[model samples]
Target chain A: MGAPEPLPARFAPGARVQVRRADPPGHVRTPWYCRGHAGVIERICGSFANPEELAYNRDGLPAQPLYRVRFSCRELWQDYAGNAGDAVEIEIFQHWLEPA
Target chain B: MRSHHDMGGRPAGKCEPSEHEYELWEKRVDALMMLLSDKERQLLKVDELRRNIESLGADAYDRMGYYERWMHSICQTLIQRGVISIDELGRKMAELEARDGRA
Candidate 1:
């Protein structure tokens, strides 16, 4: 961790956001399940070195904000077997999200 | 490419959470990998390691056990980063096998 470089959060807590469904070839952290799904931003997980770049040994300079996005299980999986009330959460890099 | 590692929703089978004994080597493998991932070490990042594992061919990924997958990924990363060489590793393995009397 380095000195906190204040970066503006793109989405606010409780804001609706959608995960980009772009399946660009290469290493990515956004799981396939969450792709194209709309969810609520649970919280801003603060700025950190971008993992996508970090994987390539590149300094994740100008860290990006990560968000804990929450989605209903029923919404995420059409054939979801768990309770409809159940939800799936994933931490997504800000770059992958867009206002819904 | 969508690797087998991301098959979360695919219909595989029932969610039978089977409990099993952890082999000593498996435990050690986990610890060793984590140690290598320490900030001071920076030998590999978790995501980088994951991408390495995911990039494996489907046959290899499906055939490997959990810790076996970790072992393979760690070894591949070390080799790719030039931190170690396959020749050196193979030589060490041969020496160990010889010491163990495994012709």
Candidate 2:
């Protein structure tokens, strides 16, 4: 059988992106609250850990750098104050994001 | 007359337990209790979330984007709370696949 295909790495710092929330039974770091929500990448944290690898007993899998994403509270939460520019920073595993 | 069977319970076995032994026993029991309680709490949370999802009904579920957003939050919470380590969560997913007989 052919070797397993390497997982795709997408998105980079300063890129706008949205998280896709597939159902359970898959490894993903993007929180549900932020899925389908738009945000700008604040930093391209190095890839060192893959949540899928760690979740599947593959601790030895190459470390994938986690990105620190910044999402505006208003974008994520309805009824968020229009005047307040609140934001939340979350570390998302590489697979969680895709270009908006 | 001597009774054929001792009416009084035999004196409690007098094996003096050491302080270390007492501590070890206490720790073991506490760990077991915590593990059990943690599992129960995790199951309850999962159940609650599932019910909430179900109650939303199919159309609403998609409209609200329930699976994509809410599920991820629950998984993150589980990781944050230490109820399940990242590895354990992976194992669970693997098990589900195996059950479905998916290669």
Chain A TM-score of prediction number 2: 0.75
Can you give the lDDT of residue A84 in candidate 1?
76
Candidate 1 residues lying further than 4 Å off, grouped into runs, are: A1-6, A79-84
| Candidate 1 lDDT for residue A37 | 96
What DockQ does each prediction reach against the true complex? 0.64, 0.01
C-alpha displacement of B51 in model 2, angstroms?
21
Model 2: how far residue A99 lies from native, Å: 0.6
Candidate 2 chain B minimal-lDDT segment of 10 residues: B1-10
For model 1, residues A66-98, the per-residue Cα lDDT tens digits are 999999999897887898779988999999999
How big is the positional error of residue B52 in model 2, measured in Å on the Cα after superposition?
A: 22
iRMSD, per candidate, in listed order: 1.5, 24.0
Q: What is the number of backbone collisions in each predicted candidate, taken in the order shown?
A: 0, 11
Which DockQ value does candidate 2 get? 0.01
TM-score of chain B of 2: 0.36
Candidate 2, residue B40: how far the Cα is off, in Å:
32
